[model samples]
Target: MKTSTPVGTQADQLQVTEDGKPLDAVRGTRAGDLDLRRTVLWWKGFEEQVVSRQQELHGIGEDVVLAAQAADTALQESPPRLAGEVFSAVAEGFSTVPGEVPRLLVPWFAELARSIGREVSTRSLADAAGAGVTAVQRAGAPPAGTPSLLDALVPAAEALVGAEAAGVPAVAALHAAYRAAADGTRRTVEDGTVDPGALLVAWFFERGTVV
Candidate 1:
């Protein structure tokens, strides 16, 4: 379905004020708190391993891509299901991890398929999560083991499915998954099993530019 409104324009309109401050202002403050060097390193690795080779990494089906595009179009044209404040938060959260919007469509499509009573395999979800772990390693992060990363990514995929089932906007559902994944990354970092630099790489896949 064609959208009369451009996606960027629609996204811009959704950026409303929260507590008398624009959401972007809030995001900017949050962004300032992050480690710039680590963030840049992570983005570089992700851009090379994941964003630059999304199709090769994820192996997403054409049908899923089409479905995700259609859903995004619908969101662009229709009024948002979430309140402005909530929508802005979701948008900001998703935007934190660049290039995640498209990769996330894989799980989003899975949810839509299941909603229509189509049987979706759990293996498909596992593959998606595993791909992310592989991307992190390829991005120059030390080997943190697949199981630890999967422990975080698997639930993140589930969060996307759950958010979709709750009738949230596609963008918001993607953000939900990102938040879950970010939480996992945070825990992994805290455990000291993974480097802080690795958090940046994981954030990109869990959520980068080429070096």
Candidate 2:
């Protein structure tokens, strides 16, 4: 629960390749590239919002749903089921973004959410991310019913948020990478021609959308 947590992936099976790098929240990801690119400034934007603020991720508004109530028309991040709270909470507060979020959600991310087959108009942010993630695996198909996306990353987000809330700089840096991967995936899918399912892992790598 403290900031001493080592960075890892949402899925227990997947691992982050930190290489032999120093985890510095103040400096941002040890990423060698992407810092020089112009079209994409999110690397730094995310760093400022999330990574640099890692010690505060826990304070990221646990009321993810309560805070998003007015913005979220459907889902609520209530007890026993706050797993997918990101979707609803984000929907409720996304319009006032940056300041509103513990970490920044992807900007103009709705279209990509829809691309991932999520019902953007209805689901919460956690749910939408879930849908986006699921869409890629089903070959661009939407989930049949209640299968949630937040369900996949919830624990990781929570764990990372704990570090942020605790004020751990290094942990925050890892969270920034996660945001970059999330947003970058959305940017790439905007092309309207990429296959959602095919680019699952690419989203985490900041390749934009996919091949």
Tell me which residue pairs clash in candidate 1: 43-209, 47-208
Q: What are the per-model numbers of colliding residue pairs?
A: 2, 26
Give per-residue lDDT, candidate 1, residue 67: 32
Q: What lDDT tens digits, residue by residue, belong to model 1 across residues 5-64?
A: 343432222222223333221121222111323333322333333333234223232322
lDDT of each: 0.36, 0.29
- TM-score, cand. 2 vs. native: 0.23
Tens digit of lDDT per residue, candidate 2, span 2-62?
1221223222112221232223222443332221131123222322222222332233433
- Candidate 1, superposed: residue stretches over 4 Å from native: 1-147, 190-202, 205-211
Judge candidate 1 at residue 137 and give its lDDT: 41
